[model samples]
Target chain A: MAMDEAGGAPGAAKKFLYVNRKAPYGTIYALESLEVVLIGAAFEQDVQLAFLDDGVYQIVKNQSTDAIGAKNFSPTYKALGDYEVTKLYVEAEALEERGLTADDLMEITFEDEDDDWAEKPSINIVSRADMAKIMSEQDVILSF
Target chain B: MATLHTVNKSPFERSSFISALNHTVPGDKVLMIEDGVISARKGNTFADLVSSALSDCSVYVLAPDLAARGIAEGDLVEGVQTIDYGGFVDLVAECDRTQSWL
Candidate 1:
């Protein structure tokens, strides 16, 4: 297909979305994917980052990563704003079922997790259907 | 709108990959990486289902996985692309969204 002047599909802006569902540090794949997304953002692309399933662990609060000799990098997720990368989506049910709430999570505001995903918020919860909808609208996506 | 689905495990081992494939639209690409490459072998259900669902969408297997498994490239079914890390990156760049089925 044809990319428009904005580097998106014909005639409009493009959205680059990344999905992460794996636990933290289980493998380097998720981390590598995150780095790629960050690089993509550097190119001045619209980026949205989402976490689901086990991937929720990457943003959990009070992680004892020091025991594993890994730096507490979960905190860096909040720093994504420094790059002007504000789109952050999380699966609401994933956190609720896992006994986690925004208060229990690292200090962050989440969008509502609805399947419609109509309102595009900087940070919010998204239902699976909405996630799929957002994915369909994007010009590029990276999943880990 | 290209939807790239990444499957990282064998088919029988996990229905999540199959579920993901079932939900995929025509013209969407599927890349089998890590142990997921094993499903590309002929006679596997995943190999058959993918071919039937998408004739145009590209299917690929990671080169390292095939090399480590000692499976010759020529042994795989027709139309499956074998790519390295860079080609994989290209897929990431080209698609609109990617989902990992593990």
Candidate 2:
């Protein structure tokens, strides 16, 4: 595989890791961070998203923004596949700490174009140590 | 290469400001935005830390964030430069990487 240089020619896709540590709502970080990810998809970069700490709550099922008067954007995660962003790493420790399980998260998937449009799960449950290693290997780390 | 350190929380509300300051190296640039702009104001408790950091690194405050909070240019601490959103983009481009202290 050819490696892409930073801000270089086309096809030069740099690895972009977006770290989310904040929960959705109460603050604009989570929503704004998603906006950046969506916009960055245009660059065709190798994108990876990590959800840890309070950020794990973002993918929880049945989030109702009706009472809070906020637009429910949790569904956006399901749309990430269309943008070619399918890597969503959820920290196992974070989920356990919050008393959540993989089953509690929303079903987010992407169509594998190369695999004959097969539907694939986007979420990858990983240990904290594994996530840390992944973070160390990224070309760029954008945290929120 | 210098890192662009961004802090979005207020020092009065969180210790993110102090943590960001402690982690920053001599050549790094600290850009205060959102509620973090509160720490850039003059005569505040964190004024000393901001002033001290200025001697070794560049300190900046987002103009729009300051204006949004009614913090005038004159209210900024000494040696702290104020930059607009365009400047923020430029800073990100100029630095090796960005570290946001949430």
**For residues A16-58, could you state the per-residue lDDT of candidate 2 as single tens digits?**
8898878899899899989999999998989999897788998
**Which residue runs does candidate 2 get wrong by more than 4 Å?**
A1-11, B1-98
Name the candidate that leads on TM-score: 2
DockQ per candidate: 0.35, 0.17
Supply candidate 2's per-residue lDDT for B35: 99
In TM-score terms, candidate 1 sits at: 0.61
lDDT of each: 0.71, 0.88
lDDT string for model 2 (B1-102, tens) is 677889999999987687567656667899999999999999999999999999889999999999999999999999999999999999999986787878
User: Clashing pairs in model 1?
Assistant: A110-A124, A111-A123, A111-A124, A111-A125, A112-A125, A113-A125, A140-B95, A140-B96, A141-B96
Docking class of 1: acceptable
Model 1 spans with C-alpha error above 4 angstroms: A1-13, A96-103, A109-122, B12-102
lDDT of 1 by residue, A1-144 (tens): 234544734545466777777778877756776678667766776778877766777877888876788666776676676666777787776677688776666765333346353333355777665665566666666767
Per-residue lDDT, model 1, residue A12, is: 55
